[model samples]
Target: MDKIVSFCKRRGFVYQSSEIYGGIRSSYDYGPLGVELKKNIKDEWWRRLVHMRDDVVGVDSAIIQHPRVWEASGHTATFNDMLVESRTSGRRYRADHLIEEATEIDAEGLSAEEMTKVIREDERIKDPVDGGRDFTEARPFNLMFETYTGPVKGPENLAFLRPETAQGIFTNFKNVLDTSRVKVPFGIAQQGKSFRNEITPGNFIFRTREFEQMEMEFFVEPGTDEEWHETWIQERWDWYTGLGMDPENLRVYEHPPEKLSHYSKRTVDIEYDFPFAGWSELEGVANRTDYDLSRHAEFSGQKLEYIDQGTGNRFVPYVIEPAAGADRVALAFIVDAYREEELEGESDDSRVVLKLHPRIAPVKAAVFPLTKKEPVSTKARELYNDLRGDYSIFYDETGAIGRRYRRQDEIGTPFCVTVDFDTLEDDQVTIRDRDTMQQERVPISEVRERLQRLISTGSAAAER
Candidate 1:
């Protein structure tokens, strides 16, 4: 965990938010490379779920909506976490998390009083900050961030920052149906920011107060909800592994019937193995048996019903949602790609490599000039410009070729293109692959075509 954190800071992947103010508690800001990597992940998701599929379309709704939306969605009353403050340091934590750390027991189902009693009785429990024995009673803390709608600061004008993108899709269901040519068995996808007032937003960006979500709600016939739910679970699983995630490190956890969410008929989480948490959710696919649309219809006094022209049947559509956190997905990819391997025939010598698939790599390739001399630098810059129009290319001329390659490897650039003296005579450059360490000399004009095919959808380079 320390190694990953250090690498992230050293490589401009992420930084603590508000660093000048001695750094904000659990908030983080993505750097240049981090932003590019994050964008690529989102682009791929959009490509797979929206653009490539004919049945799914996307929508972007406001981050702040009518307060009645929450009332309809049940977020106001149920979106909460168990909060307990430590008497020693006066720091707050999620009681369930605190309980797990102290006794290795799952405390999510416990009542507030039950959790408080356990905290008081356990001698092993001490404030992690100051190691004091005193503590406060557990209580429910609403996760929504409340704000005033306008100049009015009264209860009637209070509004909330959306806690999930799923509600936005539900609220806009009729608007999309009326505007678009979409019909039943179609989907509405969205990607946007969501906020939660987390009690313990630790483990880096794995948990945070502000985060982005890529969520899709697929509307289908009520009777077919379970089948579609399983179908989406399989598809989401393939999505991660298809992009080079190790299947062994990913699993599907089916939610027990007794513990399912209020709106969920069935829920299955796609868990990824993290070094810190062992295994945690990467995404979730849920069968939401028409609860959302039904609630919205009842509250809004509008019919969010779908009339099937083929069967001439009028009814509300069931929903199957596949929701994921962008931050968590990026972390999972980074952790899975990190590797430290010893160099061949060398003792106490090793190299760090981020073997990110080309599709998700921050930099697609690095262009290098053999030396700072005129001809080499001139040719390399031209090639860099050509590729930059199509891909993210890095141009570096100040370091030794081997050292530059190592740098690109560390940041997960898939290939390195070098312009040497031979290039002036043969019109060819040497291309090195990051993972295999194999070099291929190809004509200058062919680099673009080769890389395009290599990184194209479902291509070999993308899968690797």
Candidate 2:
């Protein structure tokens, strides 16, 4: 876990937020390469969930909605964690987490009083900041971030930063139905920022106060919801595996009846073998039995039901939601791609590489000049200019060719193009594959087409 975190910082993937001011705990800023990688992940999600499928449509909802939206979604009342503050360090933590970390107990459904009692009785349950057992009684702490709109600070002006993007899709359900030609079995997909006042946000970007989510709510007939739920579960699993994630490191965990959320009739989480936290939830697919629309309709005095034009039957559609954290998925990909390989003949000589999927790699390919001299550098820059418009291409002339390749490998660039003296005569440049370490000489004019094919196929030697 520490190795992954260090690599992320060293390779310009992520940086602590407000680092110049001593940084903020659990807050991080995506650097240049990080932003590109994240954008690629989101783009691939959008491509598969919205563009590739005809049943799913995309929506961009606001981060801040009306206060009543939370009330209607039951988030204002139920979206809370059991919090306890330490008397010695004055630090706060989730009571359930504190207890579970100290003992071999499943603290999923424990009440505030139960958690408080466990903390008071257990000697191992000490504050993380300071080794003190003194703590306040556990209480429910709402995770929503409350704010005031306009210039007033009253109940009427109260608003909340959305804790999940799913609610926005629900609130705009009627609007989408009226505006688009989508039918009953269609889906509404959204990707946006969400905020939560997390008491124990840690494990780098695995859990954070502010993060992005890629959520899709598929509306279907009530009777067919169970089947659709399983369908989506398999769909999500296939998505991860299809993108090169090892199937052995992924599993599906079904929520027991007692552990189910209020709105979820049946839920299954897609768990990943994270380096820090083993088999943690990377995404959840839930069968929401029309609870969201029913609640919204009851609260807003509006009918959120769908009427089948062919059968003339009116009923509220059940929802199957696939919710995934964008940051968590990116982190999983990074962790899965990390590798340290020893050189063939050189003892104690090694190189670290990220074998990311070509589509998800931050830079598709890098352009390198053999030397900082005139003709080679000019040729490399020209090739770089030509490819930059189509892909995220890197141009580096400050380092040795071997060092340049290592730099691109560390940052997960799938291919590297080198312009050498031979290129001045043969009009061909050497393209090296990061994973296989195999080189191919292709005409300079064919570089873009070759990269396009390799990236699209996610193969090092697709044409070969």
Candidate 3:
């Protein structure tokens, strides 16, 4: 865990948000390389979920919605985490998480009192600060961050930063139905920032007060809700593994019947093996049996039902929701793709690489010159510019080619193109594969088409 965090900071992937002022708690800023990686993951998700699927379309919702939207969605009344603080350390924590840390025991189904009782009863659990015995009582803390709307600050004008993106889709259900050509079995996909006042936000980017989410709510007929829910779970699992995630490290955890959310008839989480937290959720698939749309209809005085054209029957559509945290997915991709290999003859430094998928790598390829001198550098610049129009590329001529390759490898650039003196004689240059460390000579004119073909085939044949 420490190694991954340090690598992220040193490689310009992520940094503390307010580092100059000694930093902020659990707040982080994605650096240049980090931003590119995030964008690629998001683009791939949108490409598969929205662009490729005819039954699904995309929506970018506002960060702040009418306060009533939350009320109708039941977030205002029940969105909370059990918070407990230590008297000696003055540090607060989510009771369930703290309990999990203390006893390798999952406290998900336990109530606040139960969590407090378990912590107090267990002799192994002690105050983290100075190992003191004193602790504070557990209480429910609402996770919503509230603010005033318009020009005034009062209860009448209260608003909240959206805690989830699903509500926005629910509120716009009628708007989309009235305007679009989509039908009952269609889906509304969204990707946006969501906020929660987390009691304890730690573990790098795992749990934070602010984060991005990629969610899709598939509305289906009541009888078909369970089947659609199962289908989405498999589809989402395949999405992650298809993008180079290790299938062994990903699993579906079924939610206990008693622990399911109020809106969920059945829920299952797609969990990944995280470095610090072992197995944790990467996404959740839930069967919300008309709870959201039905609630909104009653609260907003608008009918939120879908009409079947063939049967002429009007009914509320049950929802199958697959909600994933963008931050978790990005972090998982980095951690899962990271590798360190020993150099057979070198004792000084080991080779570190991020074996990311070709389609989702931050920089698809890097262009370099074998020497910084003329013709080599000039040709490298020309090739870099030519490929820039097609793929995100890196061009370097500063240091040793080996060092440059390491730099690009650490950032998950799959292929490196080097323009050498040989290229000046024949229109051919050396293209090196990151994974296999094999080199192939190809005509300069075919570089673009070759790269396109390699990406389409996932990775170059030589990379194997």
Question: Which candidate has the highest lDDT of all?
Answer: 2
Best-to-worst ranking by lDDT: 2, 1, 3
TM-score of each: 0.96, 0.97, 0.96
Which is superior by lDDT, 1 or 3? 1
Q: Backbone clashes per model, in order?
A: 0, 0, 0
Model 1 Cα lDDT, one tens digit per residue, 376-426: 899999999889968788999986787888889899988889999999999
**What value of lDDT does candidate 3 attain over all alpha carbons?**
0.89
Candidate 1: residue pairs that collide: none
Q: What's model 3's TM-score?
A: 0.96
* C-alpha RMSD for every candidate: 1.8, 1.5, 1.7
Error of 1 at 457 (Å): 6.7
Cα distance off (Å), candidate 3, residue 442: 1.3
**Model 3 agreement with the true structure over 1-464: per-residue lDDT tens digits:** 79998999998888999999999998999998898888889999999999989999878889889888888899988998898888888888788877786788888878888888988887667766667656777788999999888898888999999999999998888989998999989999999999999987879999898999999999999999988999999999999988989999999999999899999999999999997899999999999999999999988999999999999998999999999988889999999999997776644367899999888888899999899999788999999999996868888888888888888888899889999999999989888888777789999999998888777566766335
TM-score of 2: 0.97
